[model samples]
Target: MLEIKNLSYRVENADIVNSVDLLVPDRSFMVITGPNGGGKTSLAKLVMGISTPTGGSIFWDGQDITALSVTQRARLGISYGFQQPPRFKGMKVRDLLEIAAGEHISHDKACSYLTKVGLCARDYIERDVDSSLSGGEVKRIEIATVLARRCKLMIFDEPEAGIDLWSFARLTETFQEIHDRKEASILIISHQERIIRLADEIVLLAGGKITAKGSVDEVYPQIVSDTVAGCNRLEVKGAC
Candidate 1:
């Protein structure tokens, strides 16, 4: 289990994440959603050790990891996917996946991960992860690498951003498959209802605080009702 107690992040007297507490049970799928600037990404960064919390402690499976570095946390089986994934100018797609897996994966295994993200492995396996690929392509490729890691916990920041409709559909299916396997805990920061529906639990974070947290049936309806015009609202894609 992942336990966060009194977690807070402040910058220049502004609290990006304030006195928040959360628990992600083993093998659970949780989605964090709210209006933009709700500190969703910041919270994920803190959990992944990418951002240092000004106060509070983070514990993973009864281990005190509050002071661990990002690499240390990763070594403890935590993986984080960035909102704007980074690019490796001289690395082949296959190489990146292998590095993520910490082993030389077979061609078919590499292809399977690519396929899960809606990419044709043959076409991208040798391609350089550089400026040539579109933003959406890079995003999907980065997601595939995270899958390759097969860590104990996977945190994705806005996995749906920049993805096309078809690809997004495939991505959602992949997330479902991962959850069903019960191999790891998944935490995603996404506003897409399709992704939100996959969560075993939903956390509504606003103004750097957790406003609501519960099962989908318990919390989703209220969120849908709160949608308003001329404001950042949760997106409802496809037929309801």
Candidate 2:
């Protein structure tokens, strides 16, 4: 389980994340959704220790981990997939998978992970992870690495970004399989409706604060209503 207490962060005199508290139960999926620049990404970054909180505490299974580094957090079973995955200059796909899996995975096992992310193992396992791969391909490969790690807590920042329609559909099923088989705690920051529907709980953020958090039926309606109303207002002003 993960507990965030009074978490707050600021940058250049702008409060990006306010005093927000969230409790994520173990073995469940939590989806964070909001408009762009609403601080959903910042909250995820703070949890992953990519950015330090200006104030507050983060507890993992009852242990305080607010001051821990990103590597330390990873060692404690936390994994984060970035919005833009980094390129590996000379690393082969197979080598990266082996490192993530922490063992010599058989071609079959490696293929299974790659296939889940819409990649063919025979073609990709030997390829280099560099600028040669497309953004969508790199994103899928990073997700495969996360699956290989088998971490207790996995955070995906917009897994559907840069992927084709078909790949996005496949990615949703992969997440479902991970939740069902691994039973790991999954936190996804996404605006996709299909992805949001897969969540056990939906957390809504606006202006660096959680305006609503609850089960799908309890919270989704509010999001849809607010979004439609906002769009209508914008259209009336010729902004949309």
Candidate 3:
């Protein structure tokens, strides 16, 4: 489980993330969502150790990890996927997957990970993780790398940001599969209703605070009604 208490992040006198409390239970899929600039990304960074918190504590599985570095957190079974994934100029796709796996993985295993993220394994297995790939391709590849790690807690920041509709559909399926497997606790930062509906619970963050929380059936309508600032107000689909 992941628990945060009174967390805050300030910069240039702005409370980017202020006094927030959250709990993500074991093997559950949760989504953190709000309008842009509402400190969603910053909160994720603080939890992942990408940024230092101004105050408060972070605990995972009863251990305090507030002072741990990013690597420390990763070593403790925490993994984060970037909103805008970075590229590796000279790294082969397979090489990157191997590093993420913490050991050499076979070509077939690597291909399976790629396939999970809706990528063609043979087409990308030997390619460089550089500027040559399109934004969507890079995004998917990054997700594949995260999957290779098989961490206990996976934090994904906007996994559907750069992908096409078809790819997004496939990506959602992958998320569903993850949730079904109970392999880990999933924390995804996304605003798409399509993605939000997948969460076992939804956290509505606004102005760096969680203003509302509940199951999709309870919170989805409230969000679509524009009850909070920074909300995307996406349309409901497929009888939802």
Off by over 4 Å in 1: 232-240
lDDT of 2 by residue, 63-164 (tens): 999999998998899998888899898998888888888899998888888998888789899999999999999999998898888889999999999999
| Prediction-by-prediction clash tally | 0, 0, 1
Error of 3 at 190 (Å): 0.7
**lDDT per residue as tens, model 1, 122-175:** 999999999999999999999999999999999999999999999999999999
* Candidate maximizing TM-score: 1
CA lDDT scores, all candidates in order: 0.93, 0.89, 0.91
TM-score, predicted candidate 1 vs. hidden true structure: 0.95
In model 2, the Cα lDDT at residue 191 comes to 84
Q: Score candidate 3 by TM-score against the native.
A: 0.94
Candidate 3 regions exceeding 4 Å error are 227-240
TM-scores, all models, native as reference: 0.95, 0.93, 0.94
Cα error of candidate 3 at position 83, Å: 0.2
Candidate 2's C-alpha runs over 4 A off are: 229-240
Q: What lDDT does candidate 1 reach at residue 210?
A: 90
Question: Residue 6, candidate 1: how far off, in angstroms?
Answer: 0.5
